[model samples]
Target: MIPIPRTLGLTPEQVDDLLTTADRAPSRHDNRPWRFHVTSRVIELYSVPERALPVADPDGREQRMACGAALFNLRLALHGHHVRPTVTFFPDRSRPGLLAVIRHGGTREPTPEQTRLLLAIPAQRFDRRPSGATAVPRNEQHGLRRAALDEGAWLHVVHDRPERALLRTLVLRAERLQTADPAFRAELATWSARSGGVPDCLPAGADGQESIEEEPLMALLTSHLTGTVAEIQVGQALQRVLLTATAAGLATTLLRQVVEVPHTREELRRLFSAARPPQAVLRIGWPGAGTPRHGGDVMTTATVP
Candidate 1:
């Protein structure tokens, strides 16, 4: 295990890099809702309440998941600095918005994997229409699964045919369900209209990509617990998985809506036999342009190493 330092301080360059890396996290509709507060003591993670998407993410589950991704990036940025960070999740029980507090720990050299992952941060993104026909190698899939375990989550690759069929049906149902709602479309369009995806906008033809029929290797990231703590870990697991995939020459996008609707989510959970509901579902494959919608199940799902 990496040791943690008691106190932490950051130079202007480190702080800038840290915040920059944190900002690169993928948010729903590209509405990045995470913020960072830096002190000589520790760095705190915050959620921008005003950035909440009501119609789609009514309870702020995805929003917090985005914040968790931001938090994971920040942790990696610190790791790049060669110092273990001691993190306090939901540091202030009274303040739910404060997601995590990270303090510098022991001095340790960054691992080769950590170094490579940090560099891949800028290249990592939600590739909507990535070419999924090409398969991901077994080694990389294991690494992706391990990344989730390294953090506090499980990566379940959807493999059963019945489950895959159910997932596709449920995903399509979610798209129709969301499309039928006028408010959902308006909100989605509003985000899409934003200039250059500024402030907020539908990313990579949002809603459109969700309908992609091609099923990729679907990896479901689930937390051991429920509520804030689990969601936060889910985000971290997500980034780790994404970065690992990116590093392995694989591309990804979130299969969000399937897990968004309550009934569909329960069905997805039952499909995987997951003890707790998953935080996010990932569609992974070779990188390509014209991204697809929250892509489908693990067509060639592999067990974690």
Candidate 2:
């Protein structure tokens, strides 16, 4: 076993706590495709390609985004300890798995927003609900938008019915194509089944069609730039937005089908006249009374090898 990087200014227990929280970030099939390597003074983030789902995420975009989410959580955990994290993306092109490097920076108290998000890290979940789509307040919507902007991304809230109708068409088309693929279905099942008999399966009504009509709120995460670095930024922005929504007592789900299919994703970009490519679509709303804040098998594939 490798010894802890004591020069990084974190105790062994603190390192364990930090990594546990970081691994809690949501992923496509909860794949947790992130690995951390601690050097004398920095924490490095890596993407484990073996953990990726090639059929569902052929280009490895979602896997990279998921690692980005882990990066955000790791940053938040550092903030919780009052240590600022200096981040660098793709520091070594020769080592492609090296997604980011985080060095300990100046110590500062956590901001109110950061504290709220830190507390919300555990509450955030990839919720699945067929109904109970209450409207998100305008102020909260703006807050979510700002959360994304803070991380260098944009959130486009879909409020127009006609625009939503077009998105609905694209989503349906993508879902149909995916479901018809035997490999896709098998890949989806492999992950869903790994949830240890939880209700993580793709149910009939959860096809995201009803969401366009009754989900009350839907938003797309977009970035001005494209490629690996932009995807990492979008992932961090996605986690920040999700944590903000959770802190505000909102439930969120990913309308991933819309962006998973290549042609459908292109059509979505055209539909929105987006200057940047869309990274993810979020279905945000309020959960019903008695609804659990978190309910699913929280798996951690975060390895320190």
Candidate 3:
């Protein structure tokens, strides 16, 4: 373990670079609900409640997850700088929005694998288009799972035929319920429009009846813990898995509708044998020729190392 430091050693430019990478983290509808406060000792992460999706994520689970993803990116950037990051989740219960505090622990050289993930950061994007017929290889799938494990979370790949079918039904049912809700539709429209994505339109995979049925390489992220802190960890795990897939030249789409609906989320919990609370579901595959709905410019940005 790296020794902890009392104060963060990052300069203003370094801090800006860290936040730039953090800002690129995947979010629900690209709300970018996280904020960072730079103190003399550390960089503090907070969730912007006003930026959260009230209708789709009332409990703020997705917001916290988004923040966690940002935190993970911040950590990875620190690793690239050869600075170990020490993170404290929910440092003060009174200030509930303050999600995490990251201190400059100590110096450590970046590993080759860490460098790979760091380089993969800019290439990560949310591909709402349909994936091609190429399947994710077994070794890459295992690497994805190991990425989650490294972050203290679980990745359940729905390989069994019956389980995959049942998951598809659950996803379709949740999509129907969400599409039927005027409030949900309105909220989704607002964010989609803001993000310059298809306004008032769900992604092909969001209502992905055909994709879910045909694509058997489905997976859901889970955790043995629950509530605020656990959700944050799940977010970190989610981003790690995403970056890992990106590095391996795979495409991924989030099937969050299933977890957004309470009833379906509970059903999914049962589907996974109640081992852990499901945070996010994913459809992973090789890239296709489909046009992307949103572009991730991290690969082009000089902010990330």
Compared with the true structure, model 2 gives a TM-score of 0.91
TM-score of 1: 0.84
**1-305, model 1: which lDDT tens digit per residue?**
33232336667666787888888877776678888877668888899998888888888888888898888888788899887888888879898788889887888888998898787777654445545576667787889889999988999887666666677777777767777889988877776665244323112234434424454576788998899778878888888888787767676667667777777788878877889987777777775544432233212111110
Ranked by TM-score from best down, the candidates are 2, 3, 1
Write down the lDDT of every candidate, Cα atoms only: 0.72, 0.79, 0.79
**How does each model score on TM-score?**
0.84, 0.91, 0.89
Show the lowest summed lDDT stretch of 10 residues, model 2. 296-305
The lowest-lDDT stretch of 10 consecutive residues in candidate 3 is 296-305
- Tell me the lDDT of candidate 3: 0.79
Clashes of each: 15, 0, 2
**On residues 93-179, what C-alpha lDDT tens digit does candidate 3 reach at each position?**
899889899987899999998899888888875455556777778999899999999999988888888888898888788888998
Total clashing pairs in model 1: 15
lDDT per residue for candidate 2 within 1-305, as digits (tens), equals 77665545888778888889999888876778889987768889999988998987898998888898999999999999988999999999999999999998888898988898898887655456543655788999999999999999999999999888887778778888988999998887787787653443223234556656677787999987889998988889998898888887777777678788899999999889998768888777777445654443221111111
